[model samples]
Target: MSLDYLVAQPVLEAERFILRPVRKSDTGLISHYASDERVARMTTSIAHPLPPGAVDAFVARAMAEDRSEDVWVIDGTREGGAELKGIIGLKRMDRNQSEVGYWVAPPFWNTGLASDALQLLVGSNPLKNDTMFASVFQDNPASARVLTHCGFKYLGDAESFSVARDATVPTWTYSRKL
Candidate 1:
């Protein structure tokens, strides 16, 4: 499943959630979850104490055709669940590859939501990537477990700047050959 079509935007379904393109209405929910200090610090981009309109800008960017990444809302409402449990995305990289990124709200932590979402995404191989890459802060062992449980092998150590932390954090990189 070459994700080339995703450039046109498509809805992907998982067992418990609907992964769809971001929507304007999601701003409030997104802002609410993203503003959590724990959530923001875990991500590369979101800042702690989220700025005004940050979610708005993010939604706008996700909806843009020229954007480098394809983002989706982890909508679980159809299952009688939260409207927004989290977010997942893929950033296009060179050589038929992409980087996977995701975060689940604190309420959903340890509930296997991340594992399910990631397994669904990787198993689908929507991007038709020969390989996929991911990284998690060393402090976030659960995230590292999510990748490993999905069969991603440890690649090495790396460092990435966390805007919310306002510092460089050690990361454990992983990759899978699809």
Candidate 2:
């Protein structure tokens, strides 16, 4: 259950969806989902026109984590050969802490798939288990709601953020005790 042999993860079956890992083959899906201005706006680090090879670079980076962190948490719709639905990940995982970040294709909105994936990750066979942090956009109530629904409690705000939209986009901190 270490998944250490896996240089990259495949689809993870959840009660309602698949939480896979990003792959080089998934660049098309990445481009498709990242193309939308709204979705792109939610996480603007994904370049507006998403410069070519960006997804590959992202996958490369995800694979470079300390083998203890599940850097890429990509979601799909079914058991196999599923259309990539979104991406959720725990960045900068320490022995007992990590940052949760994610985005869903607008088509799959309001389905609770993101929450399901998160639950699956938390319940997955991983050793670095403990409290996890979520830095959500202050303006994205939907994300805040999802975090709350998944048992993450409000922990105030932080100016530090990975994908900051602007100086006004203060990040709200949340934590779920494991």
TM-score for each prediction? 0.94, 0.81
- Estimate, for each residue in 36-145, the C-alpha lDDT of model 2 and write its tens digit: 77776567366565677877777677665454446555455455535777887776566767777788888888977777777776766243558888876677789888
Clashes of each: 0, 0
Error of 2 at 153 (Å): 0.6
Q: Give lDDT tens digits, candidate 1, residues 97-129.
A: 999999999999999999888888888777788
State candidate 1's TM-score.
0.94
Candidate 1: which stretches are off by over 4 Å? Answer: 1-7
Cα miss at 165, model 2 (Å)? 3.7
The whole-model lDDT of each prediction reads 0.90, 0.69
- Which residue pairs in model 1 clash with each other? none
Clashes of 2: 0
